[model samples]
Target: MITVITFNPSIDTLYKLETFEIGKVQRAGDVKKSAGGKGINVARVLNQLGHSPMCMGFVGGYNGLYIKDEIKKIGLRDEFIKIDGETRVCLNIIDKNKVSTEILESGPIVEENDMIKFERHLENILEETKILVASGSLPKGLPIDYYGLLGEICRIKNIKFILDTSGKYLESAINSHIYMIKPNIDELEALCKCNINNKEDAIKEAYKLLRYNIENICISMGKDGMILVNKDSIYEIKIPNIKIENTVGSGDSSIAGFAYGLLNDYSLKDCLRLSNACGMSNAMNIKTGFIDVNEIEKLFKEIEVLEYSKI
Candidate 1:
């Protein structure tokens, strides 16, 4: 079974407006809410694609209950640790031009007891998990080594682990020698503290992670597609052109595709192709936690994979 862990979860409220007038009375044409967090989004996409991923994370208060109820309504299985403080609510305003403006609140503080409950939940889920994906930001009061520790636990339990996060959490997880990591160009640049101008540069930076004994690395470049680096070869995938309605949760979808492929024993190239397809498919939707399986299959064929010598 695939398991996804999100330390910071939220109820994502999306508002659509024909025109977002600043400092004026603006009315929304449409409003929707979804259970959101990077890992939860991944699990949602995986569930839509016929994979029932177990979502494990921290949730609390009324907002947290809403998140749990929404997850159940979507028919996804989850085991979240309840905390004292309320989970956050994130606002995404979509303008007429299809651009999204986000106002995200910092998540509630998780006390030591909350951390203990989370660890217990993680331990229980790891027993049957074949693939574990740790995604998103760490909540306040949690150490940066949170993901790193989870990565270590996965390694010890002999489960393949995929990490999708940024900043110190991702930095620490890199040192934990995860099985795979999917970081966009910006996140990669931030990790290596340098510019990744092209596929070659990305491959170069990805190779550095090999020193940490990480098995595979995927660098996603929006519109430009993605690059996959491993010990044997580098695969450059170019996604077919499509009109993008939204970019939110695309990365999480990509991680879901990759994890799903791995869990199903797909070849590395096929996994990367499917990952890119899922990302592009999510881009066609205007809402988070939304995916079109038919679009994913169509885009799957449109993805071209180029193999290169490992730098």
Candidate 2:
């Protein structure tokens, strides 16, 4: 079974407005809310694809309960650790032209005891989990090495670990030698400590991670698709261009797709194909990770994969 760990979960409130004026009273045309966080988004997409993923994370207070109810409404399984502090709410305001301005909260502070409870929850789930995905930011008061610790545990338990995060957490996870990592161009550049100007540069930087023991590396470049690098090979994959309704959670969806492919024993190329398709499909909807299987199937045929080798 697939298990996702979100250190910080939230209620994502999205608003649509004809125009956004800073420091002024503005009216929204439409509003929507949902359970959010990178790992939770992954679980939601995996569930849509007919896979039941158990979402594990810290949640508390009224907002936390709302998040849990929202997850259940979407038909996704969850096992959240109850904390004392209230959960956070993120705001996404989209203007008439589809330009999104996001305001993210720092989230509630997690006490040491809260962390312990979450670890215990994770420990119990790890026993039956085949794929363990740790994503998004760490909540306040939690150590930055949280993902790293989880990755190590997964390694010791022989579970396939997929990490999606940024900054120190991501760096720590890389050091732990997790099974796979999905970082966008910006995150990749930050991790590699160098500017990636082209595919050649990306491939060069990706090789550096291989020496660090990262089994598989996927660098997602938005519309340019993604580049996959492993010990044996490197490949470039592209998705057919499409109208993008929202880019949020595209990376999370891609991670879910890749994990799904790995779970189904798909080749790396096929895995990337599905990954790109899932991302593109998510882009066609306003909500994060909201996708249609029929759309994914149609887009799957349009993805192209090209293999590359060190020159």
Candidate 3:
């Protein structure tokens, strides 16, 4: 089973309006809400793609209950630890031109005792988990090393750990034995402390992190597709362009697709194709992490993977 860790989960409100003007009140004809955060998004996509993924993290207050209820409503298991602080709510505003703007909360402040309880809970879950995907930012009052601690647990237990986060948490956690990581250019730059000017630069930078024991590095480049870097081979995946409804959760969906392909023992080329397909499919979706199997199947055939010289 796949277990996803979201240190700071939330209810995501997406407003699609005709146009968003600063210092002006605008009306939105459509609005949607869902349980979100990178890990949870991964879990949702994993589940949609025929995988068993249970979500675990810290939650609190009425908003937290709503998050749990929403997860239940979707038929996924919720194993979140209850905390004292209220969970966060994030907003994404998109105009008719497809321009996206975000307003995110810092999330709850987790206490020391809460951390202990969560670790104990995660330990039990780890026993049944074949892979652990930890993503998102550290909540207030939680040390940056929190994700690293979980990575250590996965390392000790021999669980395949896939991490998608950035900044200090990612820096600290990369030192642990990680199976894979999905980083956009910004995240890749943050880890390597340099600019990713192009695909070759991304490949070079991704290799730098492999020294940290990270087996696979999936570099997402938005509309430009992605680059898959590992010790064995380097693959560049490109997705067929289509109308994009929302780019939110596309990266998480890509991670889920890649993990799913690995679980099925697909080849690197096929895995990269599947990952890009999932990401592109999510772009056509209104709700984050939602995808139709038919869309995925059709997209799988359209994705192109070009392998470069191995390292």
Candidate 4:
């Protein structure tokens, strides 16, 4: 079974308008809302791909209730621990030209007791989990090394832990025997504290992360495809150009695809191809974290994965 963790989940609200202006009253042409977090997005895509993923996190108050109901509506298992504070609401304002503006709220603080409860809950879940994917940022009142703690546990249990995050949180888990990490180019740059001018540079920077006991590193370059570096080989995946609708959850979708491929024992090349295909498919849809299975199947054959020589 695959388990997903969202340390800070939210209710994602999207507004579509003809155009957005400063200091003016505006009417939205369309609005959509759903349960959202990087982990939730990964689980949503995994479910659409015919996998049932268990989602674990914190939720409370009315908005948390809404998130619970929405997760039930989506047929995902809810193992969320109830907290005292309300879950956050994040907004995305999109205009006719496809530009996006975001206003995100920092989630509620978690108490020490609640943290203990979650750790106990996660421990039980890990017993049966084959792959564990943790995404998004840490909430208030949680230590910076929270993800690292989980990684260490997964390592002891011999479960593959795939992490998607940036900055210090990513740094915290660098030595925890992580199975994989999917970071976009900017996030990769931030983690490495260096500039990546091109694909070769990305590969070079990603290769350095291997010493941390991370087996696979996938660096996503929007529209330009991705570079995957591992101990054995490196792969450069190319995606066919297509009109994009929304790119919000593309990286999470890619992680889901890669996890699914690993579960099925697919080769690294095939895994990267499926990952990019899922990302591209998500970009073609208006809903975040959604993909058409038919589109994925059609795209799988079109993606190009070329092995890169070691630097």
Winning candidate number (lDDT): 4
Return model 2's CA RMSD, one decimal: 1.1
lDDT of every model, 2 decimals: 0.88, 0.87, 0.88, 0.91
Give each model a TM-score.
0.97, 0.97, 0.97, 0.98
User: Cα deviation of 230 in candidate 2 (Å)?
Assistant: 0.8
lDDT for each residue of candidate 3 in 131-166, tens digit (9 for 90 to 100)? 888888999888888777877888899999998998
Global Cα lDDT for candidate 3: 0.88
Model 4 scores worst on lDDT over the 10 consecutive residues at: 302-311
Residue lDDT tens for model 4, 9-96:
9999989999999999999999999999989999999999888899999998999999989988988999999999999999989899
lDDT of 1 by residue, 163-217 (tens): 8998888887787869988888889999999987887788899999888878988
Alpha-carbon runs more than 4 Å astray in model 3: none
- Ten-residue region with minimum lDDT total, candidate 2: 168-177
Off by over 4 Å in 1: none
Error of 4 at 223 (Å): 0.5
Candidate 2's clash total is 0
TM-score of 2: 0.97
Candidate 3: count of backbone clashes, pairs at least 3 residues apart or interchain: 0
Error of 3 at 125 (Å): 0.7
Name the top TM-score candidate.
Answer: 4
| CA-RMSD of model 1 | 1.1
Error (Å) of candidate 3 at residue 288 is: 1.3
Residues 42-104 of candidate 2 have per-residue lDDT tens digits of 998898888988988889899999989989888778799888889999889998888999999
